[model samples]
Target: MARLVARRGRWFIILPPLLFLFVFFLIPFAFALKISFGEAALRIPPFTDLFGRGADGHLHWQASLANYRYLLTDDVYVVAVLYSLRTAFFATLMCLMVGYPMAYAMARATKSTQNILMMVIILPFWTSFLLRVYALESIIRDNGLLNAVLLQLGLIDHPLRMMHTTFAIYLGIVYSYLPFMVLPLYATLEKLDRTLLEAASDLGGRPWRAFFDVTLPLSMPGVIAGSMLVFIPAIGEYVIPALLGGPDNLMIGRVLWDEFFGNHDWPVASAVAIAFLVLLAGPIAIHQYYQVRQVEY
Candidate 1:
């Protein structure tokens, strides 16, 4: 009876989130998939019928795979996918480089200092994210504060063109996503046993050597977690790239947006989104399979 009750309790905990995903994620994905197989139309809902009544009064399905085919053959969309992946990769790398040091410093600090540092790290969340991005935009604009200060200091004769560039996009991503990287790293580093580092030192390992041999290997979980958090969202990012990137910056998110809203091509947009999900899911699934295998070994 106790075992049965525990099994029921486990299902009770799992049921809510499963229901939520079904309603919110799976249902929407079904609609998107249905739409992707539709033809573009000038009328309401913007896509042609998926099914119709035939002359014999029998239901007939009218689905097309042309949208997916177009996505595959189009150089524009292919370039957007590649560029989005490249930008997300670099952004994740930057976040890891910056966040790891900050996390390590916080982990090594005294309790009081750690609390203060954590507050500083989280303070950005108090304000609106859009507002923060806008503030960054203001600072980097041609006639903005950064250029004004540099011009005043005689560092340049003209205001530097910083906004609407790849640099701006990278800056926005790193700034916005830094907290995601740091928190996981801090969680892992904080729980790490200090005795291991001490033992390494006792065995004649230098500080850097101890860190490389002891600390890094132990923190692999956090590193992977943080990288995934940053990379996944960065790939689908639309606002930062929209606000900060140039016309040449063709991220997949931007391409999706332009297809849906700019061109009002819902079928193409749905196809892009479905293809993007498949592209992301493949790597993540492979990574998880390898991680499980490593743990078992």
Candidate 2:
């Protein structure tokens, strides 16, 4: 009875979290899945209506795949998907380029310097995220400091368009997600075996060669991890696009938002969401594979 009581006590602790996940997470997901296939009206109850069966009197819970087909055929959605993919790709690349060197420098710093550098990276995050984005707008606007400097230097005759464009979007993405890349890359690179590089150098490998031949390969796990971290949520990002993207640079997140909130088409919105998930499956699968490889090693 005591043993059973202990097991029951453990279950009591475990069940709450599991139940919480099921109720808050899984149930909503299942509901969304239902919404994806349901017959829907724009801004109406029957917000999503369940399908009915034919004369045989059988229940047909199967959702029509027409929503998926519609998304594929829609030119706007297609273009948005492409834009989202392109933005995310460039953002990830820029983050890696900027983050790798910074992370390496921080990792190689003296203990106190490392702490200071880490704090510097974290300092931006201490502010409200929306406010920081607003600050970026101030910095990158046509009359912003960058344009003022360029104009003063005679680089341009007029203040350049900077606030609302694809470039601004890229700038925002890099600024927002750079720390995510740096922190993980720093963690991995810091733990790297320095003696191995030293040994490689002693064995006649030059510094550049040693880095390419030794350090880079070893840091692959961190690169993959950080890239995945930045890339995944980035594809679904709405805030940065809304803030920085021009009218022409329609990204998937914006499209999803338009469907859900603007057009009030919950079924189509859910379908768009499903399509986004499908598009993301490739990168996610690759990330998962790399994670498995990391685990194996």
Candidate 3:
């Protein structure tokens, strides 16, 4: 009786998140899946029902695979998907490169200094995300802070055309997602065993050599965690690319938006979303596999 009560109590703790996921994520996914097979219609909601009563007064169920087929036929979608992937990959790499050193430094700092550094890393979250993006736009735009500084310093004769470019998109992503990369890395590095390093040094390993052989290897979990944190959202990012990137920057997110709103093609848009979800599952699955292996080890 006690064990049963304890198990039920544990389930009560797990129930909220499970219900939230079911309502928000799974239910929406199911609806999108249903809509993906639907035919586009001129009527409101703009898609035919998967199942409906026919004029003959009989129940009829139907589905169209046209949207899925259309995705395969469309070069624009293929390019957008590839572009989003490439952009996210490079952004995540940049975050890792920049964040790793910062995380390492934070880990090695004195406890009082660590507190200050942590507060600095986390301070960005206090502002609205949209506001921060716009702030970045102001910094990088033509006649903005960067160009004004350069001009005043006599470093350039012209205002740099920094906005509406691929570089700006990359910069925006790195700036926004840098904290995500840093926090995870700092968490892992702060908990790292200092004795391992001391032993490595005692065995005649140089500081750089010990870091490469010991610190870097052990921090792989945090590296993977931080990469996934940045990569997943960055790939699907619509706002950064739309605001900071050129018209040529047709990322998958923008493609989906254009399909749904600009073209009013919900079926094709849903198909694109479903396909993107499946594609993203690859990375998530790999992450899960490694996570399980890490736990087992």
Listed in order, each prediction's TM-score against the native is 0.90, 0.90, 0.93
- Runs in model 3 with CA error above 4 Å? 2-13, 287-297
Best-fitting candidate, measured by lDDT?
Answer: 3
lDDT of 1 at 294: 64
lDDT (Cα, tens digit) per residue for candidate 2, span 186-292: 99999999999999999999999999999999998889889998999788898888887888878899999988778777878888887788789988998899878
TM-score of candidate 3 relative to the true fold: 0.93
Ten contiguous residues with the weakest lDDT in model 3: 285-294
Lowest-sum lDDT 10-residue window in model 1: 282-291
Candidate 1: list runs displaced more than 4 Å.
1-17, 283-297
Please provide, for model 3 over 47-108, each residue's C-alpha lDDT reduced to its tens digit, 9 standing for 90 to 100: 99998999999999999898999999989999999999999999999999999999999999
Best of the two (1, 3) by lDDT: 3
Please state the error at residue 122 of candidate 3 in Å: 0.7
lDDT of 2 at 296: 100
Local accuracy of candidate 1 as per-residue lDDT tens digits, 1-297: 999999889988999999999999889998999999998999998988899898999999999999999998989999998999999999999999999999999999999999999999988967788888888999999999999999999999999999988889999999998998998899899999999999999999999999999999999878987888889889999989998888999899998999989999999999999899898996677557656876999
The residue-level lDDT of candidate 2 at 15 comes to 94
What's the lDDT for residue 18 in model 2? 100
RMSD of each: 3.0, 2.8, 2.1
Between prediction 1 and prediction 2, the one with superior lDDT is 1
Which sections of candidate 2 miss by over 4 Å?
1-5, 42-46, 51-62, 285-297
